[model samples]
Target: MPVTVHFAAGPAAWREYHDHLPRALADAGVQAEILLTAPDPAAVDYIVFAPSGEIQDFSPYVNCKAVLNLWAGVERIIGNTTLTQPLARMVDPAMTESMVEWVVGHTLRHHLGMDLHILNQDGVWRNEITPPIARERPVAVLGLGALGRAAGEALAALNFPVMGWSRTPKNISGIDCHSGDAGLAAVLSRAEIVILLVPLTAGTENLMNAERLARLPKGAVILNPGRGPLIDDAALLAALDRGHLGHATLDVFRNEPLPKGHPFWTHPRVTVTPHIAASTRPLTASAVVAENIRRGEAGEPLLYLVDRARGY
Candidate 1:
């Protein structure tokens, strides 16, 4: 008998995945039935989910083997007591590639002072400023997860001395990895460009507060492609206002669409992007989902399993 895979990631997601998923499952040699609505929740063997999905109560799906998340960040549904199944977060290759491109693009923008040229298109010739090369700039990436590690290594490839910090120690080939409080301070103190990619958790909320923000070298730039709550907005604005920091290119926020009246929208030194750093492509994401479901049936360990204690 074929296993039942319930698609609970809402209407738009259904439209995106409906065509790709079945082909991916077939390519993976998995016999499965994908259902948009499961009349008998107990019959569901697996669930494809997203935080924006309609299904809030996982209790009814008693027989479901796993809850496969469609996004990398699982903060929205991680704390739900009703969800008891093994949860796995999406780690798509395409998404990783896109994130690396965004990070590299922005890092280069700041390093070369591209904005100075782009924004000043007036006929006046202002070629006096000569920006330093990549080798002279020091960069720090605050998270060593897949996305963070990829971005850090890419920067290091460009000869921009890259330092990476995580909650625990890591040893990536090209990255100078550090951990703990002293490690964080060490990274922040020397870095000319700081990138925030750490997950949002109880301990990480407002990780970059006033005291920590003050530690950054004067004229340092920050690029946040991670969670918004990772930095305290008030502290960031104050730092920019006093010209203690150079600039901030933020892709995520504490509140998305960022309220029209928010100061960040109008701040001269702040660049607000509409959370477009990375996105899960249905074609590639479906393959990841299919492979995991295949592994589940074969009694093998699933990829990117979220540890409940760590809340990733």
Candidate 2:
């Protein structure tokens, strides 16, 4: 008998992802039932889930081996007290590529001062305003995890003086990596462009408050493609208002769909995106989820397991 993998999601979800799931599972040397909805969670051996899916009670999934998340950030489902199943966050090559592209694109946009030249038709020829050699511009990336490390390395490959920081030390080739408070301060102080990639954990929540925001070189650009709560919006706005920060490119927010009246929408210096950075593409993500599910059933060590206490 093959693996009875369940995908308890909506009708549209099934239509979009059903074929891909089997293909991915087959590529991983496994087979699955791929049910659209989990009628009896207890009858399943493993589940592939989206946060918006109908099934919320993991308690009923008694025989389930693991609840493999199809999305990267598990903040929404992490709080479910009933979900004791080992939760895994998505880490696919496609996701890493998308994130690296976004980070590099935005970094170049700011580094070259494209906003000033592109947005202005005033025929103002800004001279010598572009970023110096990649080796000259200082970039500090918060969160040296897989995604962050990949992006940081990409930026360094461009010859940019890349500094990567995490809660703990991480050594990556061709990039300056640091940790602890001293590392944080050193990274923050000279970061002409700060790209935030930290996870939403106890140590990282509100990690970019006013004081920390002030630490950056004046008029520094802040780019966050990571968790929204990682930054204090009110404080960020104040930093922008105080003229300490030049611009903010935020892809995530404290609230989703970003309420119409939110300041970020109307704030001149802040660029609000509908969270397009590093989306978990279904075609690529199904394989990662399926691989983990296969590993779970085979009693192998699962990949990217969430730390419950840290809330990642």
Query: Could you give the C-alpha RMSD of every candidate to the true structure, in order shown?
Result: 0.7, 1.6
- The digit string of per-residue lDDT tens for model 1 on 75-140 reads 999999999999999999999999999999999999999999899999878889999999899999
Summarize candidate 2's per-residue lDDT along 1-312 as a digit string, tens digits.
Answer: 787778865666777787788898999888677766667777888887888887778898898888888777788888899998888888888989999999999999988888887888897777766557778789999998888999999999898999999987888998889999999999999999999998887678899999999999998999999989999999999999989999999999888989999999898899998899898777988888878877876889999999888777
Clashing pairs in 2: 134-160
lDDT of each: 0.96, 0.87
Any runs in candidate 1 off by more than 4 Å, and if so which? none
Model 2, residue 3: what's the lDDT?
Answer: 72
Global CA lDDT computed for model 1:
0.96
Q: Model 1, 273: alpha-carbon shift in Å? A: 0.6
Candidate number of the best lDDT: 1
